[model samples]
Target: MPPDSDPTEYKVGRLIDKYDLDGLGQELEDRWLGRGYESQSLRSLADWFNKYILEEKFNRAGEPPMDGEIDNIYRLLTDDEVTSGMRLDAETALEEKDIDPENTRKEFVSHQSVYVYLTEHRGASKQHSSKDRIGSARDTIQRLQSRLIAVIENHLEQLRNAGELTIGEFTVLIDIQILCEDCGSSYSLTDLFDRGGCDCE
Candidate 1:
């Protein structure tokens, strides 16, 4: 019920009731005039409506961008700023969907994570391949070998005097064929006691 208020304000105020920006603006304008502030144009009022009030209610707080917010999701996907696979999904969802952007951003926070994609196009969970498993095993075995070597070096003198068939330097010179057939791999033993060939017999 502001003095000199627009008819649209009163009508819109009734439509939204307790949550009416039109009435709020009218109240403010009346108060400013009462305090003798100079009148401003409706253009500024419209700007305030679009920039502050409308933006706060519908656009900010990590809400997804409006439809057509993105010109091209592919461009964002290949952008240098986004570097991980998970981030790619999130960035795309934010660009194309109507979900809150904050949650979308969280989705890409862990790229290495495994989860169901819950989309109409793809389905099902899968385990890593045998080759991947083998690679991991090899890495673990190498780490174990390095640790054993450290232990041997720490007690090198004790081991050397034990006279109990120590692996010798020449053992490392064994032919690759012999090394593979006899020991399964060259990693298991040092050349200290290799018989030079796989045909030790």
Candidate 2:
């Protein structure tokens, strides 16, 4: 079976379903699976999703959830990587919408909190699978690597937009470097995969 959604991701992201953005998690996962994983980066995946899927959602709704005042505020409030200014802006946005910022902040949940929401509150099963290790390891590793890169890029953008992080206005560059525990040899993730894994193994 394909991996189910991670609760950690849900915690770190916007309240996906609440703002008429249902199916976003599934859409992201589905597109990433069908996309050319070897050539496409996670950032590319996100851009595609936003331009196509998210934009459609915005348009079809015919209006913002709160006359455009509550646009993405819930997400910004919850995103831990957002800069202080960004967080302030989200709170201000909420105030404009006549929502209690403190109450919303109090509602901020971590992954630990949502795990309880799922299994206990929602009566959902917690499922875990570890099978076909040899066959699936590469796919899992690549997916994880891509996810990390995209996550970093997102945080960087938040900081830059808030003027808290400066990088001379250049895009962040990331490369996955893997080191073999047994042989003390290092390889780029792409090169390692292309060579069918570590030579030491």
Whole-model Cα lDDT of every candidate shown, in order = 0.35, 0.49
Where does candidate 2 have its weakest 10-residue lDDT segment?
Answer: 111-120
lDDT of 1 by residue, 36-96 (tens): 4453222233223323332333354456446543323423433457657755675556545
Clashing pairs in 1: 167-192, 168-191, 168-192, 168-193, 169-192, 171-191, 172-191
Candidate 1 has its poorest 10 consecutive residues by lDDT at: 111-120
RMSD of each: 30.6, 13.8
| Best by the TM-score measure | 2
Please, what is the TM-score per model? 0.22, 0.31
Q: In lDDT terms, which candidate is top? A: 2
lDDT of 2: 0.49
